[model samples]
Target chain A: MNIKAVVGRNVRRYRELKGISQEELAFDADLHRTYVSGVERGVRNPTVLIVGKLANALGVAPCKLLEYKETS
Target chain B: MNIKAVVGRNVRRYRELKGISQEELAFDADLHRTYVSGVERGVRNPTVLIVGKLANALGVAPCKLLEYKETS
Candidate 1:
């Protein structure tokens, strides 16, 4: 899979695991809801800082968002 | 401590472990030597794609670049 997809997948997985909506995650990350949506959809190529923000909001390490886990 | 610093340190560590100079890494990653230098110095906020490129050049996972290891 592409790098963007890996990030998007991890973001979605973590957010769902945390039981939070995109709006809540966006608010916590101090980002726009649409922007978070774009990130989760793998259409946004977020900077490392943005990734940091999302990781902070999700209470995970920044590297976690970049991890490519096998979903089976 | 900072995210940028974490990335920079990891990049430098990985690059050095591979016994490659900034110029060689730049050539393999298709980035400028100055930019790679800036990244190693924690002065550049690279995009995730750039991190991916660096990781590719270093033969590591992208998450490895973002990892925050304890430097004791």
Candidate 2:
């Protein structure tokens, strides 16, 4: 899968696992709600810096955003 | 440390470990040599998509790019 899809999927998964809303995540990441939504949809590509910010907002390591676990 | 610094440091470290030049990695990642150089120098921020490409070029997982091992 493409990196965008990987990131978006993980972001959504983690966000849901944390029980946080997109608006809250966006606020934590200092981004727009629309931007977060777009990212979740794989429509926008975020830079490394942005990834870090998102990681911080999500209370995870930046690498966590990039991890893709295959389902059995 | 900032995300840019983390990514740049890791990219350079991985690139060196693989004995690959920035130019070569750029080619593999479909990026410009200058862009790779900038990324290594922590002067540029790459998107999640770019991170994926770079990880692929380096033969590593995208999460590896985000990992920061704290030195004791």
lDDT score for residue A40 of model 2: 89
lDDT (0 to 1) per candidate: 0.94, 0.87
TM-score of structure candidate 1: 0.97
Model 1 DockQ reads 0.92
Per-residue CA lDDT of model 1 for A1-72, tens digit only, reads 878888998999999999999999999999999999999999999988999999999999999999987762
Best by TM-score: 1
Candidate 2 lDDT over B15-66, as tens digits, reads 9999999989999999999999988888888888888889889999988887
Q: Pick the candidate with the highest lDDT.
A: 1
Q: Chain B alone, TM-score of each model?
A: 0.96, 0.94
Pull out the clashing pairs in model 1.
none
Tens-place lDDT per residue, model 1, B1-72, is 889999999999999999999999999999999999999999999988999999999999999999997862
CA deviation > 4 Å runs, candidate 1: none
Residue B58, model 1, lDDT: 98
